[model samples]
Target: MTTADSSVDKGSVSAVVGDKLSGRVALVTGGTRGIGAAICGSLAAQGAAIAAGFSGNVTKAEGFLADFQGRFGTAVTIHQGNVASADDCRRVVAEVIEQHGRLDILVNNAGITIDKTILKLTDDDWHKVLDVNLSGAFFLSQAALAHMVERGSGRIINVSSVIGEMGNIGQANYAASKSGLFGLTKTFAREAAFLLERAGKLSDDSVGITVNTVTPGYTATEMVAAVPEKVLDKITAQIPLRRLGRPEEIARIVHFLAADASSYITGQVWAVNGGMDM
Candidate 1:
């Protein structure tokens, strides 16, 4: 798709294009593929240097970087670490800062799910989901905030799900973890505001660091590709649009949040669910 129609631009860069994110740096977790990859591309197209974080799949990560470079004529650093691990989260943030000198945007897009009824869910299953989906975002945000607070500007975009707001069957752990992000978003926004105030930088006219969440409905990602055809059909039927969401569509919303234009938006949840949830 054309850049005007889609979040990503597939054509080669022919002329110098002035971008809103020029000279900025961004880090996107789980960015090797799917929705995360789209976010990386979108941000890069807008002239931000990108650091793509992935937990595993070295081959896929390399391919994504190569494709991104080809599309944008710029290389993206690949950071491989499990965001669920506090140490890894710290290391990831440090590496980004060391490489880019500063981080202007952070997208907490890494996540996983173990779909099972609570009755059938094992202890490992519950803990693993929460650790990755909920705790990971908290850990990474805390690590990134150290620099962001000092700079008095930053953007933190958390990727939540419609399931977080509207519950779904067989997703107790997943739902709870995503739901926790809403609280985290609000709390972080307040804390950032307080920090700005303490620094004597708070103003009624200007915005400090912004924190928000993006809830995506059923999207056509690799994870969802695993769903049985019959189950997928049922999911599509529930959507008023009668179709699944696209990763690029969600990425575009994230791009907007990461831009300077969205400075006035914070502690808000932007839903890109195609009318799946009001």
Candidate 2:
């Protein structure tokens, strides 16, 4: 079956990069695979230390940790946490800071999808999706913000989806969860700005704190690969570019936002949707 895809491996470093993110530490949820893995590689290529978060895949996480460190030649480790739990969220942040000495960037990328029509969707379906996709990002961001606010600078980058804006069939819960990030990100950006300002820490030289979201349209990940060929054809046809997005495409934008130069940009959603939406 012909899938709208890219030739690059999600975790491979393909682009030319410099040490722009050097000395910074980034925590990426679900960073062991798919789009998340690509983001890790992108940041690592920019010289950022990585704390890759995975939920339950021990073997995969360990493999990713070893491989990522070898490939990037930077300090890299895997973190295990169920982001739906607030305590776990806090603990993960604390661990990252403790291990890395500080965390400069956070990518709330962990998410799950259980597809079922509304008539067949259970209470667990809706709640679990909301908890993992929406609440998880919130708790993680909240935990990270405490340290960021103390330091007067940090980056919170949320990975949302076009389905959130376009509302896919059998993805009502997923859509709501991803859409919720819009408000969460903007509010956090505002709060971070206000806090830094109140502390008299916002200055021309200050790196400052910022929060933003990246919403990707249909992307060529394992999840998308599982879709039937006909469905993929339909999806590609709707996309103006007629192709699924590459994970690296999404990762590049995230790296851009995580860099020091992006201090002035916040509370915005950067869409890499192949012109799926204007």
Candidate 3:
């Protein structure tokens, strides 16, 4: 029997706590700060056993773990690895399963953007963005899907950016990677459909999985902190809301997609841009 059909019994304590998630285990990549940390806290609050990841920033990861446990009264382990490495991605999924015994969600939120104009952009700069933003998501999703497929239920949410869809100056590489994530999301949704068929289920019935993408606009994250206040002000002036988005706002949408509420939504990108592109 597949893992889903096997019905491995969980401890009563876990069952009680997991009721909100109800047999769910989630891995949130790049979950140490900003939107990632907010997503981790939001999900953990709803009773999902979280395996949060960080590519660098060991100090941030430790602090996040402490805060998460203190607030939730449950320990959330932090995994450190470069998501750009395929082997490291596999190890991430492996560790999550070894610790939690099942995988139900994967949030591909780890990304980096190197800003350089096309006229001055180096091949290294281009590949670096693609490696972290696109390739990292690709590898992690591939490895995580193995466990999700066996369980016959999963949710994969890829975090993208508005610049990816609307295009931004000095961020060609970053835009390209985020744009690529859309294609990957669509492809994975199809693959998940096939797996659902193997599990004798239809899209509207049974425990098949769904994959989607969430794109956030200029949020008050560290990445945007590098921009000068004048430039940030100019940028905010164009936003209909007259301000940057909050990490918690984006985290709310992610929390929804990770839950059963979004099972019917897949292969689509939802932007939390506060009318910047609308």
**Which candidate wins on lDDT?**
2
Could you list the CA RMSD of all candidates, in the order they appear?
4.6, 6.0, 5.4
Q: Runs in model 3 with CA error above 4 Å? A: 1-19, 201-204
- Give candidate 3's total backbone clashes: 0
Tens-place lDDT per residue, model 2, 67-138, is: 764566567878899999999999999998988899999999999999988889999999999999999999
Q: List model 3 lDDT by residue over 25-113, tens digit each.
A: 77899888888888877776677777889977777777777666555533467888988898999888898888778888899999987
Residue 186's lDDT in candidate 2:
97
Candidate 2 — number of clashing residue pairs?
Answer: 0
- Cα deviation in Å at residue 100, candidate 2? 0.6
Candidate 1 lDDT tens digits, 150-175 = 88889999999999999899999999
**lDDT of all the models against the reference?**
0.87, 0.90, 0.82
Which residue pairs overlap in candidate 1's backbone? none
> Model 1: residues >4 Å from true position, as ranges?
1-18, 204-207
Question: Candidate 2, which segments miss by more than 4 Å at Cα?
Answer: 1-16
Q: What is the TM-score of each candidate against the true structure?
A: 0.93, 0.94, 0.91
Over the full model, what C-alpha lDDT does candidate 3 score relative to the true structure?
0.82
